[model samples]
Target: MFKRIAATAAATVLAAAGLVACGSESGENAPGEGNDTVTIKIGTTDADQQAWTAFEQKAKDEGIKLNIEKFTEYPPVNPALDEGQIEVSKFQTINYQAQYNASAGKDLRIIGSGEINILGLYWKDHSSLDGIEGEEVAVPNDPSNQGRAINVLVQAGLVTLKDGAPKLTPTPADIDAAASKVSVVAVDASQTPSAYHEGRPAVINNNWLSRAGIDPASSVAADDPNSELAEPYINVFTVRAEDVDNPIYARLVEVWHSPEVTDALNKDSGGTAVQVKRDKEELNAILDKLTEEYK
Candidate 1:
């Protein structure tokens, strides 16, 4: 499913450049080339509220017009970015961005990282992992997120994966259910919260759970992002390879991580996301590694 979506995004990236660019015939919001003031179009999933408004105002004060293009999903953001409809986007983690680039053959690079969302096993009726026995639990079905969901279960002593199962992209088939306490039912990543509300214990993705209004502290178990296995999940600001060092873009990243927008980021993410200041070179190295591993 993810592969198909990625391919579609790639195809859009290939076909959307002239068609979607701002000055072209049919493009809606693409920036005008040679305009006196530069408008940097940014694709984002965050609600247009406190944090973003602060950043936009700061950018405006600095003489950069910030035009935000909102998206509800991740797949289309990259395509729009590749097509020049947006200059950069803040919607994906390092692994997801790497996977999209590898699958799409586009060199989208992470310019700065903002927050880390810890993925966890959340239950509606239950409060702890021990009581989860005999209850069928829901998990993400996508390769990367599924493996992450399963790993949390393993760490919580609920289930175990078979020997040699790829840790980075495991499926339910990799689970040794005979030795496990709970059975895992794989569903689309977006459906985990619904599955949980329907009386099933679910391993929900971080950002989605927060967006669904589920409190982060409600989770029974979660993976430690500080762990080496989970580092790839840190959410980042990404741009095309050509714009990695554009002074204006770099300034935006700088202002984003400063003390000015800290409260807004926390408030907007429901106080569940962690702010991390990672060097550009280090971020690129991790992306390169994940790209090679997942390719």
Candidate 2:
């Protein structure tokens, strides 16, 4: 998935180079220029792209033009937004955003919550979690999602992490391998599904599941959205901290959470994404807390 994203990122940079040319010579302008119809650039994953049709039309009705930038991976969107090439992005979970902030030392604030992607442990060779006992398993190797995969395993009673392990970013080193039932391997986030298809029990991210032709409902075990661990995984729209209160950006977020967009997201995600309604400050508070933990 990320290979495709990397290839597209190069093309996007070339095509959008001229986009930054429209504003002042200083090149510090936001996406929209001096026009009646204001254009807001939003970055997101391909799975959520279908919802842009409804969101764009809604914004058009409000005289706010929306330019939807599609990304096949999470890494590119934040930098695009940070560089002023995009106004906002909705491609990452709060924890993932926190990971980025800690690494980049940027205070990009969460403007609103969009949806929750429930990750799960899937296996092609086994029918259930118990069936994979004593076997090797694969999970994402990224900082944020690696712990998320561990959380799923803990919830499934497969393993227990060490007492002082970071709950949100626990790695293989944190796992109590002696007490665990299966050997867990850390693989690239995009490869979990393929690993599962190749006979390893893998923890798969929801976004990549559909691409691998795996049904989320068929997972041996999945995250419970109502659970405490679920909060970090809820996807959010983020913008530069200075633009958090921009009225145009606020209105664009409003369109994103509208019923039409919600329905579109549900349809596009094949019912795997759960819509979340959260205010800006509350979302920021959550992000701030997670960012501190990430650091």
Candidate 3:
């Protein structure tokens, strides 16, 4: 197991954006007893809370106590999981998890995959290209997702990356032309949607919108997570590598795939997040490919 500091504000924001509640102790609360129950800090924001609210009720029937914790960003969950601040985290994509496992040396494993939504570029002002000719676009720094974002813009005829962008992430040096030329800016995922308010369009994940309850199809450009091109980076549940065989982890995965969870996710997300039940080999192959491709 890895040892990490209690989440710094910035780290907390990046890893599990908007997850922490005031006075909430990291991993201090238990599931059922809130005292002795193993608190699973299921990291998430708006829609996660809403859907998991129902899942938690189902878990109770099985005698498992779950504490649905909220986070705002993507960088904090692993450290929280490692420090015993949380038993598990239910956020992030396979690519993100693979990067963390490789770089942070956290030894986390994919216990299950969450039906996640796709990321789409959005600007609060126009919500379409015709409305704005020259605008600033913000993209993430991660390799695959960042590339995905840039590719989306390029596909939309927005602009192109510097041409040497690695499969994972590309730095400003990788950007050949200034963003001002294409009217786009590269920003953190957490800041993108809000940036839309200031004419800064960003590629945001579906969970972010669900948490905020923003409809992408209504006023934004969206791709499905289940699309042929997107499954490589879909969200997943992660556990300490040692816990890979834990029965509780298996139970949680089972619960997540239940019809109940499916109904809750589909209804709340407006069908953005879709449940794709895969056998272990299929998921393991996906992970292996991710390790090979993203690394």
Candidate 4:
């Protein structure tokens, strides 16, 4: 199921780029190897956010020039990194990466940790989840987020799942409709805001809140960032399996957790992103566990 979805998403990206496949060959010398300042192309969806500006300046000071490639969606960024179109990417959760690796037969490695942008249930008409009972709620159709969205409703007592539903990535199929207070309407992550505007309460990812003119702090209910459930959703920086140990990548990760970058991130997220700083080994262990479950 994941392979079919991944292949379709990849084909869409390839067609958009007007290419059959991107070259997998390493494009440049490793950073900090000689007198030349090494340039690294990093992929992300939020390139225009203030955080990247701070990150770019910090990387420059370390003799690493960064080219920020802005992606409008999540599906293409991992494929771009896999094909060597970008050297590093920082947009997906470890759970999403695990699903991608399992479905695509790729072994991308997590090099650094990033913040968990708390997934929130937003509605213009309802001040709380109590008012959303027996109504249809919108969620991201993607596997990773759809599951998280369902979990959010479950936590809010607005939905219920069948016995033995996978806790890490539950889907609508797992929902006990008879017991659930609301029926889920899965849509593209980008269209969630649209669903909300059309009068359905929606589970909007943090990235789409601003586009919908919704404030981050206005969510009726949200996942607890510090909970055990959020461990798999920790956003991360990823590189090709071969570049996992590159000093330049390590330095970039170091700079990402610095006060300047984190402060900018907090500001951009409207203080909803919880900063996470786990080591590579710990992060990889979590990914490994999730990937196995996904497979």
Candidate 5:
């Protein structure tokens, strides 16, 4: 599933790049120049969501045109933005971006903040974390989501971490199985729903809920978005380092926070998303700290 997502994202980016190349030959001034309407191409994983539909309409009303490219997974969005296939992307948390930046040696910059979707523990047969003792729980194996999933289990009092476990990026190895009530099974993020369907309670990311036919309100337990632990999980709108100060980009960020967009987003996520508002300086400081930690 991950490989397929990567391939599809790559193909979509290549096709978009071709269209951009052909469009460049018209010799028109770039967006945000003089009186030209600012047109920004945004890459996202949830372009089909009603939030984006509302965002597009609001942007149009504000005289800013948007071209949204949808991707199947989070991996390729940043690369698409870095390679100039898209101007900005809205998909990942600060921790995920920090890990990507550290590994890829790229300095993608976050220009705006987005909501944090509380990581949820969903069970098909169980209504609560209780009675799941000695059972196995599935979690996303990716560094960012896996760590958050482990934290969710910890918050639910079903798992205990060993001494000296990394606070931000804990793995199953960090879990003291002898002391914990449940054992964790890590699978690709895309397969978490499958794990849940197979009778194991799964720590599923919010983005997969719609695809897996899981109701967000049905989650047995979830991590608190307002806690200090969740600060790093706040989703963000990111762009190339050079575009960090672009006025049009700043305006676009404001548009994302508008009532229409937020209302639609809340509806789309089934109210699991907690809207976050943070300035760029604070966001950048958090990203810098996380990047250094990942390095």
Candidate 6:
């Protein structure tokens, strides 16, 4: 079942990359009304190219073509989608989307979720967390994710911060409870993989780790999926609020939840990116609150 879904996502993604027969509604795209090709432009960070490839292949058979635009950071992804420079983007957490909306005062909506999950703490020589004490721990320098990276250390019981640390701008001053002699270093997310060779234990993003061909399940000291951050932080698809009612958007959801896509993620994601079925009401309440939070 999962394999089938992964296959669909890769195929649908190809169509998303090319912009052909992309579905939308407007009498121009009335469902079951045949024979008009529409192009769908979707944006995403480069984390899920393989899964997107699976979805794109399936879209070709259905007469829709897609144009996929990739971004690296979290900031520019949604604004591009809303400008209709692209139709959708699948690069963020619900919490991230909410924050983006609130900061930008836009009404971006979550269309669906695919994969790309939490990162793992990795090292070349350390076999376990107990061995990591007093060593430098590497984390991303981005505001939201820097806090997230530190939280992983907390989860592993390697370091404890003063209460309310997450709400503040973290600096070396923020490490009120650094474990005796442990040190934390912040760098660009892109440099995390390379940090491993530098002999520091690294808290890495799931996507950056994957791009380096590292298997997260094997490298993790902790994962965000099973942490308190899971709900608001689940990765999701986003479109401008105006496009929520479109059937093509719904089809995008269908293609993601399809069995082919699921299997591929399970196999390819090192068992870290699990399929989570979010029923509509559940998603709505979460997204609604998140949207309000973003706004």
Top lDDT prediction, candidate number = 5
lDDT of 6 at 24: 45
* lDDT for predicted candidate 2 compared with the true structure: 0.77
Off by over 4 Å in 2: 1-37, 70-73, 125-127
For residue 92, model 1's alpha carbon misses the true position, in angstroms, by 1.5
- Tens digits of per-residue lDDT for model 5, 1-295: 1245643563455345432211133434343234444467888998888999999999878766787888998888888999988888998899989999999999999988988988899999777777899988999998888888999999889999999998777999999999999999999999999988998899998879999999999999999987767878999999999888655566677788889999999998899988898999889998998999899
Better candidate number, 1 or 5, judged by lDDT = 5
lDDT of 1 by residue, 47-84 (tens): 46578887777666654567788898778999898887
Q: On residues 199-294, what C-alpha lDDT tens digit does candidate 4 reach at each position?
A: 889999987998789989888999988777788999999999987865556667777877889999999999998889898999999899899998
Ranking by lDDT: 5, 4, 2, 1, 6, 3
Number of clashing pairs per prediction, in order = 1, 0, 31, 0, 0, 50
Model 2, 23-66: lDDT tens digits are 22344443434444555677787534678788778777766666
Alpha-carbon shift of residue 270 in model 2 (angstroms)? 2.0
Q: Itemize residue pairs with steric clashes in candidate 2.
A: none
TM-score, per-candidate, Cα-based: 0.77, 0.79, 0.64, 0.80, 0.83, 0.73
Candidate 2: RMSD to truth: 9.3
Local accuracy by lDDT, each model:
0.76, 0.77, 0.61, 0.83, 0.84, 0.66
TM-score between candidate 1 and the true structure: 0.77
RMSD after CA superposition, every candidate: 9.3, 9.3, 11.0, 10.4, 9.2, 6.5
Query: Candidate 5: what lDDT?
Result: 0.84
Taking the tens digit of each residue's C-alpha lDDT, what string does model 3 give over 1-295?
0113421332344234323221136544333223423334455544354568667776655545676667777678778877766667777777777777667755677776777665677776564667544666777754656766765565566665565565334444555455424555667666666775565667775556655555766545655455545666666777776766554555666667667777887777776667765554466567666666544
The residue ranges of model 5 lying beyond 4 angstroms of the native Cα positions read 1-36
Between prediction 2 and prediction 4, the one with superior TM-score is: 4
Please give the lDDT score for candidate 3: 0.61
